[model samples]
Target: MAKKKATAKAADNLTFLKTPTGINGLDEITLGGFPKGRPTLICGAAGCGKTLFSLEFLVKGVEEFNEPGVFIAFEEKADELALNVTSLGFDLKKLQDEKKLRIDYIHIDKSEIEETGEYDLQGLFIRLGYAIDSIGAKRVVLDTIENLFSGLTNEGILRAELRRLFQFLKDKGVTAIITGESGEKTLTRQGLEEYVSDCVILLDHRVVNQISTRRLRIIKYRGSLHGTNEYPFLIDEDGISVLPVTSLKLDKPVSAEIINSGIPSLDKMFPTGGFYKGSSILTSGTAGTGKTSIAVSFADAACKRGEKCLYFAFEESPAQIIRNMKSIDLNLQKHVDKGLLKFYASRPTMYGLEMHLVAIHKAIQKFKPNVVVLDPITNLITIGSFSEVKSMLVRMIDFLQENQITVMFTALTLSTVINDQTDDGVSSLVDSWLCIKDIEMNGERNRGLYVMKARGMQHSNQIREFVITNKGLSLVDVYLGPDGILTGSARETQMLMEETGQVLHRNALGRKDREVLRKRKLLEAKIESLKTEFESAEEELNKIYIEDEIKRGVLNKTRQQMTDLRSGNKDI
Candidate 1:
């Protein structure tokens, strides 16, 4: 009975302790790293960053937590391991000099070993135990346990020895990381290693469209809560950082701060001046409907207010965007020069969806922008399937909202009309949706803009006509004239025709009045000239009559004289 009580007491004291994973965003996903004083299995195919993860854990423990660590490499030499991690900012040589870190490389050569009938891994344990005790290490890493399988041909002995090695590490009370290569069918090549470990994490490296992405997922963790989602991780100079996306919950209270949408008219449409600071806005439209222009305008407005903004251009280069905006008079170069805006342009197929998320997260953390804009999120579909891209976007939007960052994502909707409720639709997940489309009106296609939905705020329901001109984008209020809401170039033509008709009518009436007045004046002048000519002709006729009368008198006088001379001759 005394011995039973002692056993119970020992079991009670064996409460599972938790270890902190030095990687940012990882501890949150696993509740708190791994089970302390227990060996955890990290299995992955070659070049999946399993060794880098283990190194990060050890380096973080020593640097941040002030806990000493022991690293046992079964495959790589000490100098080789040190060189591999130098880019991650880990100085193994420096840590070794401080006596706080210990690195042991077990050089195993199958040719040098004699084929014994039976063998135990106790000798390896003795060396690891000595190193752990010597530095009082709280963290330990055994990289690539599958290397032992290559050296040992006895499967029965390898399995038993692997179990015993894990048990020995648990007995030593050190948090250990044991990495193994993935098997063809099982979680690990040596399947027994996963069962003996307290937790199992799987890493995957895949190339899609010639772009590589590293993904991490927690397969199982005994006696602790863990995130079930596969997260995207990145390897850079600072080591591996996994982007944990499971913490998106809307239960938290929202802020009442009214943030401008960069568009004054758009803000006026919202009751709260604009969207809530952390609200997500989705701008979806057909091709050539001006989604990127709208997103850029939003970013410009944010930068104009002195709020930092980040623009991720997936479809267009920075120079191309700047040149395009020049036509609309939106100068982005000045904002970039002022450091109020940052532009990151890359091809959508440059990396997988997860890598894109990691890059955005890292940029956000570094720039701490108040607003983030992704110009055409649909471009990411090239790397992932529709469902995968949607899932990734949901997580990304959730992450942005948690940090109170206003994110605007532009997507190209293939359909002529997009409904708020539908499969593979982003409208349902977004806090606000602004839809732009081409509407057939008056024998021509015209751009139409509307607010499909804006939660927790009052917005305009009217469909506004959008025009792009040299000055920039303008929203024309719907005309309430006899011809309801004139649209397209036809409306402008009608307006011009009406204006030209009124001017022509006025000119025609003016010309008629002038003609009437000029005709009256000419008639009066002609009558005066004819009256003077008639009076002169009568005077000349009277004068000629007088002269004719005078000539006739003379002729009569001559005739009478001739008659008298003839009469005298007759009488003689």
Candidate 2:
């Protein structure tokens, strides 16, 4: 399966004959690199990092790709370039000593060289050829080819010779990178000299809102499809790193494993009992809404799970974060000591957005954490525009998800009214979004947390009261009464009042029940008394009738003597 996948990838990439540049993130954007054995023109303004880019390309070619390189510097000496790049950890002298690289500084002076007759750059060609043959170099870099215009007086001859040089390099079958100074109207300061190359990459250094940013764009690439979007780049201790803002696809593998949010109540809010592994979580809230506290809880939980975590604190120093977490009963220092937690603290203004991103990328590559926490990503908005910040976040989230690393980000919403939204515009890209804010009701403000959205899980829609104590953050049920939701001291007062009312209601119901029972018993006794009186009256009547019969019989006997034939006697 692995081999089949590899074959498929190869087939996808077979459209272009590319030579990998070995620069982080650049090769991916270019689909592989510059077209093989083709000259690519790199033009940019002064101090825009054109030189460093070409040098790194050649160096990487030698060290990584096993392609020997020849550097012909027409601007600076070999020693100067080497000294400038030493900090980037490139051992130029060592590479040269091993015959894997060669640096030839070509000095030109208008006063020293005169174009007295029609002449081609045959001597220059011989020199470059010798350097290439000596080291069997497969890569060549011509630093600022425009120097020929100053050295030679004839414009026609110089242009023709320059074209010949490009043709010669192509004939040599070596991938070459030619550096040029940027012009205001053209891709290079030398009007039409860059047209000879098949690919042209332009670098720019721009400052906006007092912050500096570097960008790269490809003007043209012949016979190959390339990305035309302007990519942000950064130059730091490592070297030039281009951050491509595109290629955020949804095809990355997702995991079914769930990771806890550290707070049991908060975890219970989600149907999965936790967040999905490799998912992006955005915690957005207003000030003092426990965004950082929530992020720290996640870090603590990850460390306790025996997983490594990276904490990026843009708003606070490491000491401040550690001390603040301690107050919440989160002892992050222990995790740091145990090598399970790493903290990278820097003010968001310390560098441009691209530099910060590059630093983060390098850290992740080096540390290989299972979880990453960005405490308060909203602070980055001060350095970049909203769209730029969103793009950077999208790229970061994409990278982490591709690696199956769960990431958490905290954002601050300045206004209480916008509590349901995110400030940096990255909320839509996250898999789970938890929004927290102050619920000001009954003349008091209390923290409230709710899951604004949790994709692929049935999350609670009720807003929970945020409670942070010495034991960390927790969610309590909000006070839902006739007056609507209440929190903080107001909720406490409402709860107390509700308890009192419930007690009184129970007492009243008990009294009413007892009264009803008493009335029922009284009615039963009255009916029984009536039944006894009726039975006694019937018995008296029966006795009277019996006595009457006896009297009548005696009377009838006496009357029969007088009237001889009383029917009564016969009847007797």
Candidate 3:
């Protein structure tokens, strides 16, 4: 046994290697690319971008990886294939001239090809071998293997030939990508090629609410870790870009600096200066509760700080958003002109939920914004289930936080539902929650803002009155007097009534004091007049006494004086 173990086999056994697909996100989803030295089947319905994906994979291998590739098209001509990918900036003819790519358009006539007994597709193999050998292709793409079945109707011969083709490709040690139209129940039209191949990818093009979205899912990739989610893919000028739905677990430290929430008074409520950088702030309220306005104001604040911000408006167009923000006194056009703000407006049902996420992700990547605003995330619920939307938000928040980008999401809550549990299904994932409510008091609606929670920071628990004016968003001090939270038109009425009441009380007190003073002055004048009369009478009596005394001295000095005069006359 030891002697037998001493003998080692040659190390020439084929090992698993990934070939680059040249697509943006496809390599990440496939864990590098498809299995090297093996065939991969890509199946989907018509107009699902199967042919484009195949061509991108081959061209990417040739141009990027420096690996020669062979594109064997069964349906399309060479000129048509070349013209189609020109928009993607891929020049197939140039690659062929450089001896890096070999594109062979196999024109098969179904009526002419005779399927005899015990026949194999040796001619097809010979053609593929010639093309691969001509350029020494390390990567091969066979688009629409089903076209072979269409030309040859014999099932046994077709299956045998397909198995032989797979074996032939494997022996050649070339990584091949095979594309086919999707079948109703199987992975591919024939189903045999999918099983024979080492990898399988399914492409889907669906129109939900009139907006078409293309999605890619890896059904199976043998011996490789691949994403299973339906990734959103876009066919643009650069070629097909797939957005992987999974996230990596890299521990990136986030900033703790407090960033403003647009409204200064609102920012003052937070004890940590403001919300933490990379935090998720949720503003939820009933319709017309200024949810979108708050979100826009936050974006404006970020723009003022010279930080790039992105505004994703699902319910309003960019022009309409600008118009509405102007009414609130937030001039977003200035920020747009300064290159600080970017607005992306689309319908929630414009595509599927995944497509929306991809669009946002791509925009964020392209803009590298510091702040991201999603006005009324509830609109996303229109296209997806509650759990689906929640899941998407969780992923999105995680992505933003990982990138250290602050996020503000607004949600429109319905008044018919009472309770926090009935929120728009995204409140639990937020770092800060601001609930705006329309309180009906004194027969008028008032806007009240309250901080439900601010994680890792102390915040005021009191409900603050908020107003949206032409200047911007402001938090009026809480009305602590008789009236609570004076807002809307009622604030004016309350203020007017308060002023009138104070004026009336002052006028009534002034009148009472004036009346009391008038009566006191009348009494004082009467007493003084009486005293003057008494004094005058006393003086007159004194004068009369003097005159009588003089007359009584004349007449008793007038009586007493008259008595004295009488006594003096008697003495005389």
Candidate 4:
């Protein structure tokens, strides 16, 4: 008895089991997925993707989890539902034929049921239970609850029936999704549906400035924690993909790895020799400052390293960018041909900001690129305000960094307040900020590139002369001449003048050395002549002295003995 009690207590204490929906990024925000063996409410207005959401949950169960699902439609028949989902690449017919999926259409006459005062889901339970048992299904979806109870206006019967339906699904041990229309103030048309469901998700579709955006928010999760932010979702040829905004945390792993900035000279400006891996780089500049060139160069560098790069072009087509970069000696077509580079070009007006973000998120997930570039993000301003754009970018950067994907955005700066605000707002969120501006000097405008900020690394403080030539983008040190800092023709002129002065000074020094050499030779010749004359004089004096000594000796000998001295002298 004690063992039985302990076992029962353990089962009660165990966390609720969750069934993964298998939709990209949906399970992340749902914090595992919908509750297993319980119904989840997916409420939204018409065309807000409630049905698609439920269908995806069912299809993904079979596809990813090996769990068959039964989709019960109250509005559309099985054939209609199948045809509707065909475009999303869902092979519903094949799944049905293979017994992996089952579809049932529920029909009701609202007028007749109301006249008869008969409204109950007892028959629904029998039918749904049989379907679940037939395929041994683990997932179920009710395309809509509004049509199921359209004949009933009494709140008490609706509440009881809704509760009963939820309990029936729970008894069957199958996870279920129930769709509903949006109410005026509440999340669903049946105001109390959110209160009973284990999980309640709200979908919203709104148009601002004529651009439509679809967002999803979790209103309530009875026994689990979930993201509360309105995550943007995308519906394209692939199906539904939700971009979880608040799912990423600040503690995501970081890398000390370095990646090149495409330009060798520019990389030299950073102490790390390149940008940090997974870092966000913002290149902001005015018109004609070669911002796109910097982005393209970065992409090329990544592709050259045998890594994939995704380029999102807002102002130019892939062909246009490739053609223009060729002038600078960068061959981007090879990377594209090698499948290392992919380009997605679209105008900012193509969709709302959130849609753009979802599209980018989808592309990144599909391509799994190591590098991403958004050329001229300034074009996004046409669709949304600065704050909205900034918010979208923050979400995007957080997502990218969480995945350890390096991203670079190029922003066009102008003298007006709009461009300034855009750059200022975005620059703060980036890991590195490279500002390129025109430096008007020497009757010509030259580009000056400088690093405004680079987190976690040392960078150059001096503004470098940014030049675009046949060899691609390069940075050169600004010339320090008599005229402060100089670039372009002024720098060249100062260098030329300094070189000329150095040549003249060398020539003058050489002339002085030659003159000194000539003077030393002349002085040596004069000294030698004087020494020869002195030696001659000394020899003559010595000869005279010897003669005097001999004469004195002869006189003394003559005085002593004339004959004897003369004989001695003759003998000497």
Please name the candidate that would achieve the greatest TM-score relative to the true structure. 4
**Candidate 3, residues 249-342: lDDT per residue as tens digits?**
7575767798998898999898776899999999988889899999998999999999999999999999998998999788999999999999
* Local accuracy by lDDT, each model: 0.84, 0.87, 0.85, 0.87
lDDT of 2 by residue, 1-572 (tens): 45954674576466657889998778878878987777899889999998899999999998789999999999999899899999998999999999999999999987776557677789999999999999988899999888877777788877887888888988887899998998888878886445555888989998877778888998888887788988888787887777766664789998999999889899989878999999999998888889999999999999999999999999999899999989889999999999999999988998888778878888888799999999888899999888989988988898889899999999888876873445577877899999887887667778888988998999999999989999778899998879788788888888889899999999999989988888877877777777777777877887788778888888887777657554444544
Ranking by lDDT: 4, 2, 3, 1
Question: Candidate 3 vs candidate 4: which has greater lDDT?
Answer: 4
The lDDT of model 4 is 0.87
After superposition, candidate 2 runs with Cα above 4 Å error: 1-16, 192-195, 419-423, 441-443, 481-486, 490-572
Which numbered prediction scores highest in lDDT against the true structure? 4
Q: How high is the lDDT of residue 330 in model 2?
A: 94
Q: After superposing candidate 4, which stretches have Cα over 4 Å from the reference? A: 1-13, 109-121, 149-162, 192-195, 416-422, 503-572
| TM-score attained by model 3 | 0.81
lDDT of 4 by residue, 1-107 (tens): 45954664476468767889998888898889998778888988899998888998888898989999999998899988889999999989999998999998888
Q: Report the Cα lDDT for residue 284, model 1.
A: 83
Query: How many residue pairs collide in each prediction?
Result: 0, 0, 22, 0
- Compared with the true structure, what per-residue lDDT tens digits does model 1 show for residues 75-147? 8898999998997889999999997889999988998887778778888989999999899898999987778
Clashing pairs in 2: none
Instruction: Tell how far residue 548 is off in model 4, in angstroms.
Output: 20
